[model samples]
Target: MSLRTRLQGRFQLMAAALVTVVQLPPVLWLCWLTRTPLPALAALGVSWPYLKQLQSPWTTTPRAPSTYVALGWWSACLVFDVLMLPALLAIRAGTPADATWGLAGAVALLLGGDAVLGRPRLRRRTVRIAGLPPELDGYRIGQLSDVHCGPHVPEEKVAGWVSRLNGLGLDLVTVTGDLITHGSSHVEAVARALGGLRAKDGAYVSMGNHDYFTDGEQLVRELERNGLHVLRNRGVVVRRGEARLYVAGVDDTWTSRHDLSRALAARPEGSPTVLLAHDPDLFPQAVERGVELTLSGHTHGGQLGVPGIRRLSLARVITEWTAGLYRRGRSWLYVNRGAGTTGPPVRLGAPPELAVITLRRE
Candidate 1:
């Protein structure tokens, strides 16, 4: 193998090893201790095939088996974490046998409920923005992001999301990015699905970290081919009657391409501006820059959560603004939970969401 190939091989191995290390303890606890044989088999069955594939050198050919296996493992990990609570309790409390059964029953109930409730659905939110033009009041904007379009994410799911957005009669639609999971192989399919979306103003997209992994430039080209505007540090104006609303999009902050100054430079001085950023962490920066409204969707609200308890999301550890709306003074940010899953095909309390934000003049 070439020197570059060797280095890449080592990196992939390190990553696989790290994932195994992170998952091993919890898997063992749920399986061996709790006497949950299914989770243990699932953990090994899914991971072993993918681990074997990783041992092979990287190639252009799609590793569908490995990819699907990895997704199964990720889903298994989610179930294991949920069962851990009862599994631990069963071990420490008397009558371990009964507790083991309880663990299985709880897991089944939770998983079944999650599968039904966690399906991607449309959620409408009204944001009253100060200084919004009177003519622009009650304007609707659709936001979708973090669509990890790969083997696990069905094309029909993408089509359904597009259809829902089109049916909303939205004035504007924004996709914050990560359209595909890893590579540009599925770009055409994603673009085709999104091409069905309709809006009065236009459909615009910003780059995400995953987009960068899949030849960001090519992805941009494909999206533009489907009539979606790929804004990379650029601004556009949407005229509503006599009012001019500015819309700007910066590249993915995770890739260090986010430039608020360049993005805002094209906007007219007094126009109400809406900024599109993939990561919500830039909310403070946008706030400082006097951006009226910002839209984002990177954290997916931990993908797993406890309903009615917002703090239950693991995303809190990374971002204070995990999901929903947050305001700092006159600036507002709405982080969509996203319309798709990433690592796993499953979701818990944090269901896949398509945010329809209606802007009302305050």
Candidate 2:
């Protein structure tokens, strides 16, 4: 192999090995940290030493390995507050501390609330456009993101989400990429799931990091084949009511290597613009290009974060609005919490979400 190829191969090997090493320590530490006394159970042999050590009746309840693992994670987080406090404190010198408390207040605020409330607090955010074209009134855009389909996929569950989207009665639907976990095998199912959607403008789609890792070109072809507009650095002049709106889509932050110029190239001059990008971090360019609003989803709100405030540090590399609408001067951006999971199946403080953006005249 060439030197560069050999080095890359070695680095990948090291990365895989390091992941295993880094993840093992926590299990070892938690087991060694060793909470409470144990009483022998006869159900399955002598049983694990730490099984009875759990303080929660729920954690100790007989359940599947996944359930035990889930409870074990929550319990470990509860017990390990002292460990996470320092990091939170250090980071908060620049940001608010209550948000840290919000994240760290796992037992009472998160787990307790999740159990008691049984639902997340959602906000219906509305923004008025002063410069919006006169003909466009009640212009609605629906967006879904990060629907990473794979093994153990709740197709029916996802179908429910799709059904909810259809109920919104939106003017248009858009996706912020990561349609499948690895490839296009089940993309047709997703198309069918979202196929029932009736939009005056039609559906638009983009590519994400996972799409590149999977088969991006194939996805674009398939989605286009299924009647979804796959915008790869392209723009379409969509007529909303009597007004004109430029709906543009950029290549994903990681995959298509986005270029706003190419996306806006085909747009009519001086038309109100809305950009559909996979990462909301592309706001500055969209703003510079006179985009009035942008829609995105990639962070999944850390997928393991605190509510109300964001988990930017947890996802350190992505945009700031983990799962909400944010404004930077004249530009507005809505970042979805995402519709699926990656790495782990649990969504703690965050939920899979679909965003409805309604633009009204001033």
Estimate the Cα RMSD of every predicted model relative to the unseen true structure: 4.7, 9.2
lDDT of 2 by residue, 130-242 (tens): 67886766788888788776543445655766677777778888888877655455666666665655677898887876666545676677777778898889988888566
- TM-scores for every candidate against the unseen true structure: 0.82, 0.72
Residue by residue across 1-362, what tens digits does model 1's lDDT show?
A: 86446645664765476467547766777677678777667777767766665453222236576666676566666566667676777767678678878777667746643643245767888888787889899988999999877655657788888988898889999999888876556778888887777899999998887676566777788889989998899999999898999999999876588898999998987788899999899899999999989999888876667754667875786699988988998889998888776544677768788888888988
lDDT of 1 at 199: 97
- lDDT at position 158, candidate 2: 57
TM-score of predicted structure 2: 0.72
The parts of candidate 1 lying over 4 Å away from their true place are: 1-26, 29-46, 51-77, 84-118
Worst lDDT run of 10 residues, candidate 1, spans 52-61
Give model 1's TM-score versus the native structure. 0.82
The alpha-carbon deviation from the true structure for residue 105 of candidate 1, after best TM-score superposition, in angstroms, is 10
